[model samples]
Target: MAASGKKNNILKVLLIIVLIIGLVAAWLGYQAFMSPSIATSEDYFYVHTDEPYESVIKRIEDEGIVKNPTYFKYVAKSMDLQNGIKPGRYKLSKDLSNRRFIGNLRGGYQEAVPFRFQNLRLKENFAGALGKSFEADSTTFLNILNNETIAEKYGFNKDNFFSMFIPNTYEIYWNTKPEEIIDRFASEYKKFWNADRKAKAAALDMTPEQVSVLASIVKGEALHVDEMPEIAGLYINRLKRGMLLQADPTVIFANNDFTIRRVLNRHLTIDNPYNTYRYKGLPPGPIMMPSIASIDAVLNYNHHDYIYMCAKDDFSGYHNFAKTVAEHQINARKFQQALDARNIKK
Candidate 1:
């Protein structure tokens, strides 16, 4: 009878030990699968296209994004994440749990990348910047930008293609194709030429394209926002009188050299249509990417009789405007002297 009692007691103790083990296992499973697995380290993780599973897991471990890579792997495998990997830019947060984090990636949930276009001096530079910002490479982007056939679809040429891109920020997926980017910007350009802006352009007796052309020159000439209107007014005066634009910026564009600090007589004689001195109207396209401010300044140009402008000799990033050639020559001479004193021969 005592032997039977001893056996019963031993069995009861064994059952209790089994129950404790099961509870511990359950807790660990919950922690691994349901609790947060990401650390408070980074706010983003980009799972590049065509990346293999092991590389991604290793990268997650290397970046300390996961609290425990082993546990993460276990949870991922259990959740069928091995067959569900999707490439994209994923948002990371410490509050993200293992299940939520893995599920978000598996479902292809991604953050939109902010792409900004501004102050790009050339299309090649713009393409390079876009390549770094998006999935499209610069060669592909440049090909699309320069393709005469494709450019015609957007009403653009190799030189005026940049006008389609309004300088602003766009939130788009990182893997957006080059064609889609072009289409989106074309849509934006079309949308920007609304009835009101179109009427303003018509009031100036100009096409939207012509406004962009003049705005680019105004932007090139003016360093301060306040000077843009006056500079634009001076150009408008010249245009009204059928005078040669004679814009130095256009000459620089014609020379294909932006480093010319002083426009010499030789530079003015460039035979290209873009050379405003040689041409009687606005350049065939914009000389540079005009900003919205510059465009608005042209649309709402200040009414004035000034037909000429020269950079201020005071070096205050302002310009001196005059209605007569004599006054403009004086201002030009002063600015030229300043440039010569500083040895800016180019």
Candidate 2:
């Protein structure tokens, strides 16, 4: 009876040992199959400009950069990277563990390049510069601004193509679509337009577009912010009296070249609708992109009876105002004398 009891005890101990070994083997197998491998593989991965999150996962899977697309999607969701993935060209490899890769993507590993719009004149050049910075299609982007249908929808005429846009520095994700970027800028512009500006535009008997046109001229003419209000008033007075604006900027625009070192009789005769000297009322559109200061100047213009202005030779950025041609000619001669003395011709 003692021997049989001992045999039963040994059999139980052996069974328990086998069961423990089996459990451990199963656990090891599960871990090996579920975990990402750290073995390096030759694969290229790309994240297109403005590509959605789901598309990014598919690209990762398709390029063999990740072992499983569904698993990556799950990880990305848990990390809250669904809508936060930046657009750019990314090079990835399978050597990275799943956790490390997810962390990298969520951390925003791509670089941001800034596109600045300062002292720029042409709309096409602006589009091209932005496109090049973002690796987008420059031609396609510029074409949108040039398109008659699109321009009309945006409340733009041929003359106002460049004027409608405000200049500022923008940080755009690489590969963003050109149209998407334009829409983004339009949305940003709304912050500059408040109720007060809208009411002021209404008081001037002008649309926001027309106000922008005047503001652009103000931007090009004024040498300082302090000069804008009075310059704006001078133009408004001329408009009210049915007198020619006779702005030198208009003549420069009509000439289709900005290097107007001197304005002459020939420049006045080169003639397009933009020449306020030849045609009455405001030019067809603005001559340059206006700053907020210039826009505000036109909106809340000072109520003055002055109709003419000439730049002061003192370089104080202030203009001499006159109400008659004779007074204006005297101021003009003063400016001319100063210019001639400085070897500047007009």
Candidate 3:
């Protein structure tokens, strides 16, 4: 009886030990999988193209995104996240668990970054801005824009391809392919030119690209929103009469010198198609990205016989419109006098 009793006690002790061990293991598993791992400092974690999984782990550690790297690594390994890593911008929430973070990465739940640009003067400027906003470099986008084949594929050439990008805020993924971005812009362009807009363009005897070119010119000339329609009307009148646009903004663009406050006779003689004073009608392409307001103004232009506009002498960013050369010369002289008075010699 004594031997049997001792054996029973020994069994009870062993049972207690096993229970303690199981509880400890459960606690450790909870700590690794259920504990909050993410920190609130970073809003996003970026994984670059072809980046090593080990590098991602190190980045998480180095960026202080996770409180415990070991726990994250263990969870990631268990879920096979390394094999399913995707390159993108992932959103990081405060107090996220290791399992949830790893699952998000594995599932490729990326955040869409807002890409916004406007009033850019050149394609190079746009490319540089776009490069800073996304993973694709400036050279990649610029090359695609400059490629004759790609431009032609989109019904444009290198010279006029800049007009295809309608300036606005758009949501896109960080790791979006350069070609995919162009396709998105093309889709947006089609949506913008609906049947009503197309009919208006046809009535004005201009294509969508031509309207954009004029809209850019109008945007460059007009500072006030209300004046845009009048400016558009004036340009349309010039185009209809077969007269040179003789726009000073085009002169500034052709000279590649935006610092010229005043356009002179010397600047007008530039040997470039963009020089509207020397060439006829619109430029080969838009000098700047046209705004939606400017574009709509062109589509709804105010009809008038006034063909000339000179900046008002008051420097209120308003222009004096005239119907004839004699009246336009008077307005120009007043503006010149005002510039001289202000010592704005270019």
Better of 1 and 3 by lDDT: 3
The lDDT per prediction is: 0.87, 0.75, 0.91
Candidate 1, 133-152: lDDT as tens digits = 88768999988887888878
How accurate locally is residue 132 in candidate 3, as Cα lDDT from 0 to 100? 91
Off by over 4 Å in 1: 1-4, 39-42, 61-64
For model 2, residues 221-258, the per-residue Cα lDDT tens digits are 89888889888999988888888988888889889878
Error of 1 at 208 (Å): 1.4
Best by TM-score: 3
The TM-scores, one per candidate, come to 0.91, 0.70, 0.93
What does the lDDT read for residue 36 in candidate 2?
A: 61
Worst 10 residues of 2 by lDDT: 37-46
Cα displacement (angstroms), candidate 1, residue 229, comes to: 1.7
Steric collisions counted per model: 0, 0, 0
**What are the per-residue Cα lDDT tens digits for candidate 3 across 1-346?**
9999999999999999999999999988888899777875878889998999999989888888888788888888999997998899988877788888888788888999899988898889999988997899999988988899999999998888998998898999999988999999999989998999999999998999999999999999998989999999999999999999988898999999999999998998889999998899999999888888899999999999999999999999999999999999999999999999999989
